[model samples]
Target: MTKYSSEFKVKLVNEYFDGQISILGLSKKYGMPSKSPIYRWVHEAEANGLNYLITKKSHKEYSQDFKLSVIEYHKLHEISRLDTAIYFKISPSQVNSWIYRYNHYGVIGLRRRPRGRRPLMAKKKKKQTRLNPTKEEKYKQEILDLKAKLHDAEMDRDILKALKTLRENDPNSKKQN
Candidate 1:
């Protein structure tokens, strides 16, 4: 659909209220394809003043639950999209879009998703290594690493000894590969 400027909408609405031409006449005069937009503009202007006809810079974001309720209300009342839009003070096209999304994807469709490409993974920091360590530091580090490895090996040996005893005691237990 063509997007008309707020000024153009106000002018058309004013002309409509002038009592000189009907909506169809104004549509023909202005070469608008449909009278629905004019009707909507007039309704909005009358209900919420001319300022409401202006497109807002920041569109209102509806929550997923709010969208679900709107869809439920529309369905429960069996109302047209235009009527639901008017009741909710939202655009008819928005109502239609929500309904379409809800029908196609269930409630998850109403959820808002981040818009854009995914960010690249962060680079891992490099570990700092000592270029030349003193003999004492080198020996101490080697001792610590060897101690850790020895402790791990001792733990594994003890666990294996326990498992072997259990298997020997329980002759019915099958060995697992």
Candidate 2:
């Protein structure tokens, strides 16, 4: 990805401000993928002055003060992921991941690297066991068993009643019904 310098962003914004080109035209002229950042730069420039145009070299040399300031903002402000992402010009998901990592691991979490293996839970297949039957299945099985037992009990009662009637009518009155 081509990282445009802050100065280039400011220049483009200025060109749009001066009525030399529309924001969309300026973006096309500069080969910018989107006009939103340019529009943001223009707004910032108008509010903060032209000094914001100065671009620093791409280096991992953020002062301790800056890092501390960012940490302080994160700690002191209960900002939502979307709000933080908009403020930082990053994706909301990135902000969410950063917050998650920071909460768990502190400052070191902010230094994100490409993820390696998937999390164990995600990588492993979910265990399939009948020991923990779902509610519906358990209820269905209970109903089936109850129905079977009821049928058997009804049959047994019918057979006993028939024997009793037969014994009473028969001449063998000594036999137990």
Candidate 3:
């Protein structure tokens, strides 16, 4: 939610217009953190209309050219970001962000980028076999594989044999069909 309501903002702007209190005085009277918001509100009202005060801005995407123009106008006029923002009917933070990006990365930095985490790269699996193998080499590999399988089967058979012998010797062992 917004810190200040639209009616309250309008009241403050109206108070400022009455010429009784300065921005700082109004801020102090209302216990505002600073007069920056008042300045923005006043500018917004003056630039657009009173409706601009009541209406909330939704998320907007500015084109690269529009961003560049805003930046250029700001640079050329030597105005504050708030002023530039009010002039362009955008938030001051948007102007600040664009300026920052432009300074760090130039005009291309204003371009919109894809959001969220990038897709993970898929890993390529290496081939297990060579492109070509001699018949003798293939036969030798097959023999080695078969021997390994046989050894595993023999080990399993021995374990079952040992388990059976232990179960037969144990009087406490339960018999099952």
Instruction: List all candidate RMSDs to the true structure.
Output: 24.8, 25.6, 27.3
- In the range 28-92, model 2's lDDT, one tens digit per residue, is 88787998777756765675566755653453434323433444445445455444544554444
lDDT of 3 by residue, 103-156 (tens): 765654666777789658748665776235456535544554565567678889
The residue pairs that clash in candidate 3, if any, are none
On the 0 to 100 scale, the lDDT of residue 36 in model 1 is 86
Task: List, in order, the clash count of every candidate structure.
Answer: 0, 0, 0
lDDT of all predictions: 0.78, 0.60, 0.80
Residue 46's lDDT within candidate 1 is 80
In candidate 3, what residue range of length 10 has the lowest lDDT sum?
130-139
Return model 1's CA RMSD, one decimal: 24.8
TM-scores of all models?
0.61, 0.37, 0.60
Residue 16 lDDT (model 3):
89
